[model samples]
Target: MYYGWNIVGVGMVFQAISFGFTIYIFTFWAEAWMTEFNVGRTQITATFMIFNVAMGLVSPIAGRILDAFSIRVLIISGATCLTVGFLLISFANAMWQIITVYATLISVGSVLAGPLAAQTLAAKWFSARRGLAIGWGSTGTSIGGLLMPPFAIYLLLNLGWRQAHQVIAFLIVLIIVPLVWKIIRNTPQEKGVEPEAPARFEPTQESGGQAVQWTTIKVLRSRNFWIPIIAFLPALAAFSTVQANLSLITADIGISQQKTALLMSIIAGSMIVGKLFFGGMADRWDQRLLYWIAASIMGFGILLLMSQPNYTLMVFISVLLGLAAGGFLPLLGAIVGGRFGPEAFGQVFGLLGPFLTLSAFAPMLGGWLRDTTGSYDSIFQIILVALIPAMVSMAFMKRQAPATQASG
Candidate 1:
């Protein structure tokens, strides 16, 4: 029995809550806030952009900071922020106030408490089984996303958005904080255990099959470094834009909000399958190839998701998208951890924040296209166009060579 599994359980629970409250839950309120504030669609979209920007700016720094201390401290602190942020937003009367809370506290706090931490925790504790560990851990996001929305929507209906925010905040403080304190330890050595495979040095060739140390500077300079970043950017952009607006999109197309909410859950439920399936399989399969194939499938899903997808058709598309998104976290985590080792994972992953957050603007773009063209058809077309190069970028990514191998 390993203590790391306990950490993963805590991470799964907390990350699920984090993703649920931070971004997915917010979608339910977008229209409510817009109507209350008397703002337009673009204005509503900007808040999410601010959230992404804030997470982008803060995550890398938070990652570095997490590397310096015990994870429990960060999770507790993050839970506090989330609680207080929700408390404050409950009383907010203006759009700017809501945006400020989301950007400054909720988004940053989410990075501290969510999948980033879970992934890092998994990376730290496991080496040979890193992908599977992270995959199970990353399921929190999808599970949270799956379970939270319908419940949140119910809350939104019965409790009202303001009170709903308060309830959400209180739940985070009550549920997540104690769990973090009880289960999470920074490394396995705290419990007198060691990582399964500290380093894999069997390969002489520079393929992605080793655990080698990498500095942030060296990583930024490598072609392989940008592979995941550039390769996945479009998918992430599409994901960011679609998830944030899926509720509104469904409403626009004459679907019931209840049904639309179910669609959100369907996407999330499918993600659990993808993450779990890919996570376990990554150990035995080529994670890189799996990701490339998944990304291609997601592109096709986006093509099928137009302004007026039939509910039946929408359900199928959601599954494809969910599986794609689900597979991404573990594959990316495994690839990075597999190539770079865990020592610099926090720092290396932090550097990815800016590029990753860059897609946050995709929602903003969708808003702009909506306002201009009166529909999301153009945005979907733009996403399809962008996926072309995203897939192409993976071709140039090479496995990193260890320092001694390079010197020889």
Candidate 2:
């Protein structure tokens, strides 16, 4: 296999391993923790809040660190912390113990090993195929989403939740941790290799050897940056609200838990296809047009989700939403990378993550609305209304043509 492809493959594995423990498997533990620990849903969700905090806060710092330090150290350290955190969680008997293990330790570990590292690494390695490489590497999320839920459910059935964590920890330590420590490297320069390829757009350096750097402040000040936020915010609300309530929504319309789970699997499986196919297609498409199309598909998916919530409808909506969910991440990254260049990517994108993460609160808020209003219809309508602004805003995010540089 080509070295670049190898890197992407390993990166995908690492992401799967990391996210499996952090998210997909955690849902399996939700019932166990509440049953055993006598905790509430809010308490269980608090762990996810801690995760968001750590990930959002660490992103900018991790970006700079990737520039300054070797990726091997970051990857290994992250894997170790995540694995150890899960193992420690297996021994948890108290609320504080769960909080420490799930919220604090795993939270910290996930930040170091997440999308920022994988995307940044891919950014450094590939120039011409940057979008495709980044997309492939980042597909770890979809893979983890597909595999971990069923695997977790199986482990929960057979060995119990705690034991599942222990097993997952062991696998991570034995496989991903060691492989990363041995194989993952920082850059071609660090490996004593000459640059064998050039980018489509090379840096315009000054006489004093400074490449033009786009500061986080400068990027934030640009209209292009904020315009996309409008699309992202409502899209976040729509997608997350549906995901959080999908099983419930289906069950309300009389589907059994078994069939609901199967439908969820259908969504996850479709994501694998969406991630690979759409990710590759992104590199060749007009990014602005692509964003609009993706957003439109997402909106359509939400509309479908709101329709019947029957078995057939559930399958169709799941496939549609799965395509949206799988495609959004890499496409968003490409929009940034193509517009801003890799040098400024970390800071610009880092700043954007918190707003997106805030979408988690949308589901929580939607739940509150459901309780007070006694129906999910209003919330779904609100989400649909929000998409209009998102579409309009996305249309405004095109890159400005650069001004000519004069000779000194």
Instruction: Name the top lDDT candidate.
Output: 1
**lDDT tens digits, residue span 1-408, model 1:** 667888888999999898887777776798898889898866676787788889888887887877778889899999999999999999998998988898888987899998888888998898667778989999998888777877898999999999999899999999998889887888888767765754343222335444444656777886666888988888888887788778768877788978977887788889899999888777667666777788888888888887478888889988998889888888888777766667666777777888888888887788778879989889889888988888887767664334334432
Candidate closest to the true structure, highest TM-score: 2
Estimate, for each residue in 36-135, the C-alpha lDDT of model 2 and write its tens digit. Answer: 9999988887776666666766666666776568787988888888888988989888767888665566876776777777777776666657778877
Over 4 Å off in model 1, which ranges? 198-213, 251-253, 306-308, 400-408
TM-score of each model, in listed order? 0.90, 0.91
lDDT of 2 at 115: 76
The lDDT for every candidate, in the order shown, is 0.81, 0.74
TM-score of 1: 0.90
Stretches off by above 4 angstroms in model 2 are: 193-196, 199-210, 400-408
